[model samples]
Target chain A: MDYTFQFGVIAKHLPYLIGGAWLSLLLAFLAFWAGAVIGLLGAMGKTFGGRVLYRVIDVYVVFFTNTPALVQIYVIFYGLPDLGIVLSPFNSVLLGLTLNCGAYLTEIQRAGFQSVRREELEAAETLGMSLWQTVRYVIAPHIAKTLYAPLSNFYIWIVLGSSMAGIFAVEELTGRAINVSSSTFRTIEVFTYTAGIYVVLTVVASALLALIGRHAFRVKARIF
Target chain B: MIERIVDEIPRFFTWYNTIFFLQAMGVTLALTLIGCGLGSIFGFALVYGRQTRGRLFTPVRVLIVGYVEIFRRIPFLVLLFIVLFTTEGFGVRVSFFGIALIAICVISTAYISEIIRAGFEAIHRNQWDAAEAMNFGRVATLRYVIMPQAWKVILPPAFAYFVMFIKDTALASQMGVLELTRVAKIFNDRGYSAFLTFGTCLLLYFILSYPLTRFGQRLERRLASSRNR
Candidate 1:
């Protein structure tokens, strides 16, 4: 099997690849933000709400945990249209990934929420803080401290997981690799180059997340 | 349509296709399991390597960091393609199945190593001193004193990662390995009821993974309670 490896042919597709990387960043960031907000709500519901709410959140986590993110994406990308609900490719992928991340984040945040000491809550109450104020000023900060590392880790996980968006033709970095591989007929070369791009993207994302952890959460995150 | 899908199941469950998909699932699952298993070993090795206080510790530390970063950064799909086509020389052509398994193991090792490292760090320092005071060697300490405890702490992360590994198997489907997702794709292309086909596939994966998550949660709770006691 004589196979010629040509860098030039694939090199021409660099711009598109870069664009895909940028799109991936956008997808991940949006999903991260959305997941964070929903995670907070779900965590709070599970922790503070009645049994029904807790049960609801429990089911949510089980469903999301059990299903593949790719399957989630496919369900939204392909399954929804069958129900007469048409979503754009990008929106469908983003929605799917965000919801998936939210479920995982909800579980992580719930752990953090459960860790806030009862004495701390009592102290907040003794200081005449309302329930909302106690949660806002006291509980949230405590959860923030415990949750920061896992949250950052989850952010990185979602960023890497977003590579699967390629399957949906969302024009993320992985999708571009598929295109490049088919066009170049150099499946190995195209994917290898894409692999390098992925490494850079993940590294950059991890570093940026670490920086955010330092500045935003004021927490020292040990990145392994 | 639902009745049609019900009928197709027994037809699709032919001897040849059954063997093919089961073999495919087996190949995919084995690749991930072995990859994760080897990765865990390497990961544990790094954890112990880091614990060895020495002048060369800095480089060892950097190597571990570099390993995790490199593997985690690259997409598995790309790794599969590259390793499958390349890495053939000296009269050794690594099979597609081989490359897929090796690639997953390579990636799994990086993550597993870090998880093991974290588990080690979570162990109280005094526990080591207690083991040392008992005249236990490093191996003995790890095996008898540390590992049982550390495994509990690591179970939540490791078990969660196992589920991630199962999901990651879908990526190999793109490389022409007919796993669940691949079969779903084939069914879709063949004008099978796409809804029933994919819905069933999704259900199958859910059935497989949900219990693992629940089991991990239970183990985690038990560990926490025992630690408190």
Candidate 2:
């Protein structure tokens, strides 16, 4: 019954833990940007591409959304080698998360596109805007405005889900926690601190997003 | 391409023992059901405890808030690591399945509680007052006045969440549960084709999850139609 708590054990290891946190944030950051691009393209394809492209986009969206991100990661990480395209753990995890995020964001952005009015599209057309120009000048800003809140939510989801990078031994926050726990055998201390840092990261980033959303985009980004 | 596809079919089936897949499916179902089932019970307890402004329940309310806040904010993988490792370090011998099952239940409770509480919040304040006027006990009020409306709101999304949690079962495979993902990994270790092994794994998961996806969509449509009246 005498379980002495050792707060001291993990104190000096704080820097390593934070370094891992930084990696988690970095991975999510990179994946989000990459995914945003893919999503923009995929959404465009679904919205404007012919039937063939629409069906291709649909398959990607349905499969990626339904399956676990981990399995998707496994397929790209393992299955790609079968096709002679080998990716490093960093590349594999990044690619997998990006593809998954792309699928979700494609749907999110498609909703944004649907919300764009015909008058706006016609106005852009009257101004001699090319298709790309119309999308960039007309559709993009509106999507940013309407989609900011949901995108912020997805950003936090990515932050948490990126913890799976640890499973691949990617030396992220969860990976470092596993390392420290096994080394010090202070399982509770290590993971408690790790989990605390994750919360702090998610909260701080979400608050920043909410603020940007409220002030810059006028979206009601009411995140707790 | 036809020949390649045909070759892959046999390579895929080489690892396909109906019993093996069934066993993995069984564990996956067990994890999802136990987690969602007990989680809903405990989550309802949390919700009901929080609703009571009784002096005795104040600490419980605070505890419930803190529990949901922590578990919801933090990722489940970290919680699983904490539980699996902490229990092991303390020399509390248990199977990884036991540890993973508890972790999933605890983690899912936070999410399920949040969704349920959203349903709880949608009930009008006057409804509760009416229940009080009718001399309903707390349990009776929740059962009769509150939950029916909440269930109408909660059932569709809650079922979707359960489908999501079924996929989450694969995460427990890292803790060494022989779930579908882990089974595929085992076969991959035996020098089989990764495409066929994990590809079949993907197919099995698709088969398992696709119907739930349809059901969730149907529930939403049904709820929307029923609401319009």
Model 1 chain A worst lDDT window (10 residues):
A215-224
The sequence of per-residue lDDT tens digits that candidate 2 reaches over residues A1-224 is 33456979899999999999999999999999899999999999999999999999999988988788888888888778878899988789999999999999999998888889999999999999999999888887898887887788899989999999999889999989888888997888889999999989988997899889888777776667
User: lDDT of each model, Cα atoms only?
Assistant: 0.78, 0.86
TM-score of chain B of 2: 0.91
List ranges where model 1 is wrong by over 4 Å: A1-12, A130-136, A185-189, B1-28, B49-61, B87-92, B126-141, B227-229
lDDT of 1 by residue, B7-78 (tens): 778766678765655565566567667878887888788777767767868898777778776887776766
Q: In candidate 1, list every pair of residues with a backbone clash.
A: B35-B105, B39-B109, B43-B113
lDDT at position B192, candidate 2: 68
Question: Which stretches of candidate 2 lie above 4 Å from their native place?
Answer: A1-4, A117-146, B1-16, B54-56
Evaluate residue B88 in candidate 1 and report its C-alpha lDDT on the 0 to 100 scale: 49
For candidate 1, what is the TM-score? 0.85
* Residue pairs of candidate 2 with colliding backbone atoms: none
Task: Estimate candidate 2's RMSD in Å.
Answer: 3.3
- lDDT of model 2, residue B94: 76
